[model samples]
Target: MTAGPAEALHSWMPHSPCGAWCLPTGDALPKVSPARRALRLATLVAVVLTGPLCALTLSVLGPRGRAAVIRGWFRMVLGALGVRLRVYRPGALSLAPEERERPRDRGVLVVGNHSSWLDIVALNALQPVRMLAKAQVRHWPLIGALAARAGTFFVDRPRLSTLPATVAEVAGALRGGAAVGVFPEGTTWCGQATGRWKRAAFQAAIDAGVPARPVALRFVVDEQCTTAAGFLGEETLLTALLRTAALRGLVIEASVLPLVSPEGHDRRSMAAAAEAAVTEALGQPEAEHAVPEVAAAA
Candidate 1:
C-alpha cells in the first residue's frame, strides 16, 4: 500500500550527522576565567528573569514598539551570554529602493541554516519574526514561556500526522503578513557543517506567495570560526549553556542573502535555491556526507 503524505514526510525527517566529535578541542577552544563565566551566567539568569516584565510591557505597545522592545531584549540576552552580533545586509542594499522596503510591506518567509540555539537569539536580535521551533522547546524552562509569548509555532517532530496542520498554521501566519522564520535544516549541527533543507517549510512560503529571505549564521571566536557554541548530539541544555558562557570573544555574524522569489518554482526547487545561497554565504561547500533522506530515520 502507498503511504500518505505525512507518512512519507515522517520517513524523511532531517537529522544532522554532527556529534560531539565536531566540537572544538584543546587549545582550539577559547576559555574565560571561571569567575567571568559565572558572571556571564548570572547576568543571563537576571536578564531571563526580566522576561515576564517585558512580556507584560509588550501587551500595551503597538507593533513597531513591541518589535523594538523585542529586539532590545534579544540583544541583551546575547550580551549576557558574551556573544556579540554583527549583521551584514548587502542583499537588502543591492535591491531597488522600493524592492528593498517591500519586506516590511508584506509577509516574508525567513529561512536559514541551523547551528546553535544562539542562532535563534541572534536572528531575533536582528528582526522579530515568529520562529518555527521544535515542540520540545515549548516545554523548556523560562525560555519556552518567552517563546510562546513571542508567537513561536511549535512542531512535534515525532507526530507524523500533524505535519500538514503545522505547515498550514505557518502558511496562515505568513498570509497574515507576519515574518515567519524557519530553519529548513530540521535539526541543529556544529557551525562548521550544515545539513540539507528539509523542504516542508519552503512549501509554506510557496503557499503564502511570499519571497524566501535566506540568512546565514556563523559563530566566530578570536577571529576564527568555532563550534564551541553548537548544541548537538548528547549535549544537554545546561551543558551547552555553560559551554557557551565559558567562551570569550565569541561573535555571531549574520548575513542576509538575496531574497528568493517563488515565481514558477516548486517547493523543492525553491528550497534548493535558498540552500545554495546560504551555502555560498557561509563559504562552505555542501556536505559530501549528507546522510541520505531515507536513512534520516536511523
Candidate 2:
C-alpha cells in the first residue's frame, strides 16, 4: 500500500503529488483528529457487532452465506470509518450481455494498489470482495481475530510449499463466485509513493480463469483532519486510527476499471492496462506518471 509511488517509480514520473504531499518518511500519512476519531468509533462498533453477528450468521449458513455476511460486515466497518466511496464513470464492470442478464454473475478478483489497511474497508464498502492478507496478520490481536472470522485468506511468504496450496484455496474461492481482493504492492506506504504491481497475485486470477479487475485507491482529507505526528510512522492499530480520525478528515475513493481477461496475455501487460485505467480515473493526465517503473515492493 502506497501513499502513491516507491522511490524508483517516483523518479520516473514527471511531477507528482508524492513530492508535494507525501511526508519524507515511513509507512503512514499525517493523522488528523476528525479522521482518527471517526475511524476509532467505527472500528469499535465493528468489533462489537461483527463477533455476535458473524457468529450467528456463519454458523447457520454455508460457506457462501458466510462470505456474504463478511461482505456486509466490512461495509459496516467502512460506514463507521466515515469513508465515502466514489466511482468514476465508465469504470463499471466489463461484462457482456449474458453476464449482465444473470443475477449470480460471479464477481471477479479485485486487484488493487494498496495504500493503507483502510484500503480494505474502502474496497469492502464499495465492491463485492474478500481480502487476501499476510499470514502474520492472523496473529495480530484484535484486527487479526476479525480477519479470521471474516474468512480472510492469509498467505505465508516464507513457506514455499504453502504458497501453491494457498493460491489453490484462493482459486477455489474465486470459482465459487467470491470476489477475491489483493494488494499487489505487498506493503503499506505513507500515503506518498506509488508501488510496483506484483505479478503473482494477478496470476491467481489468470489461474482461476476469471477477470482481474483493477481498483485504484487514494487518501484525501480536509487539511484540518490530517497531521504529521500521529501518521508519521508505524503506529498501533487503535491509537493510529483513533488519532487520525479524531483530527484528520478522510475520504477514500475506490474506482474500479474494466476487467482484464487472463487469457493469452502476460502479467506485465495486464498490469499496464489496469494501471492506465486507474490513473486516468484518478485524473492523472500522463501515462508514465500514472504507471511507475518496476520496483521492489515497498
Candidate 3:
C-alpha cells in the first residue's frame, strides 16, 4: 500500500538518531558595504579562473588529478574572496612507536562544527581535504560542477540507511591517505555559535582505526551590512567578496584541537572527549546541561 503524506515526507528527510534541538534563531548575516563592491570584481576573476583550471586539469592528467588541481585553486579562491585562514599547526603528528612505525599512508577524519557555506571554502583553502557532501550540493549547478571537480563524495542526504555505506566509503578514502572532513552538526549555524554535534561520526574513526582531528571555525565582522537588522543572503559571490574586502581586516580563525584516536577508549568517551576539546577550543561552554543530550547518546 502507498504510504500517507506524513510518512512520505518523513522518509524524505533523514531524521538524525540524535533528536533535534531548538535552533537559536539568528539575525540575518550582515554583508558589510565596502565588501559588497569588491565582491563584483572578485567574482568575475574567480569565474574566469574556473574554466581554465578545469581544462588544464583534464588535459594534464586523469579524473582524480583534476580534483587535486581544484584543491590548489580553492586556496586561491579563498584569498581572492578575502577569507584569511590561520591554521593552528597540525596538532602533533602521531609519534608513538606503534604509530611511528606505520607508513603514514592513512588519512585523518577532520570532524568540525559547521557555521556557514564559507566553512567548506575555508577548510578547502587550508588543505586538500576531501568532503563527503550532501547530494544536494551535486545538484547546485555551478557549485556542483566545482565540487565534483574538487573530488568531494556526494551522499544522498535523505537516505539514512546509506550512512553505513557512506562511512565505509569515507573510511576507504582514509585508507588511501585522503583526509575526510565531516560536519557532525549536519547543518549550518549562525557565525556566533556551533550546532550540537552528532557523535555517530566517532564510529567512522573507530572503524577506520584513524585519528579524529577536531576543529572549530569562527567568523568575525568588519563593515556593516546594508540593513543593520537583516542579513545579506541575496548578494552574489562578487558582492560578498567585495564586502569582506572592504573590511579594515577580515580574519577567520580555525583552531584545530587535539586529535582523538582509537586507543584505550570506547566511542562514548571518545565522543565526549572530542566534544569537550572542540568546545574549549572555541571558548564556548561545554556544559552537559546545555548541549543536546541526544548528542551524547552514542
69-130 per-residue lDDT for model 2 (tens digits): 66566656655655544444241244565433213546477877654666777676555466
- Choose 1 or 3, whichever is better by TM-score: 1
Best by lDDT: 1
**How close is every model to the real structure, measured as TM-score?**
0.89, 0.71, 0.68
Q: lDDT for every model?
A: 0.80, 0.58, 0.56
The better candidate by TM-score, 2 or 3, is 2
Could you tell me which residue pairs clash in candidate 3?
28-231, 35-242, 35-243, 35-244, 36-243, 38-242, 39-238, 39-242, 40-238
User: Where does model 1 exceed 4 Å of error?
Assistant: 1-10, 91-93, 284-298
- lDDT score of model 1? 0.80
Give me candidate 3's TM-score against the actual structure. 0.68
RMSD of each: 7.9, 8.5, 9.1
lDDT of 1 by residue, 199-282 (tens): 988889899998888988888887778888888866677888888988888888777777898898999999999999888878
Q: Any idea what lDDT model 3 has? A: 0.56
Count of clashes in candidate 1: 0
Q: Which window of 10 residues has the lowest lDDT sum in candidate 2?
A: 289-298
Best by TM-score: 1
Best-to-worst ranking by TM-score? 1, 2, 3
Candidate 2 has an lDDT of: 0.58
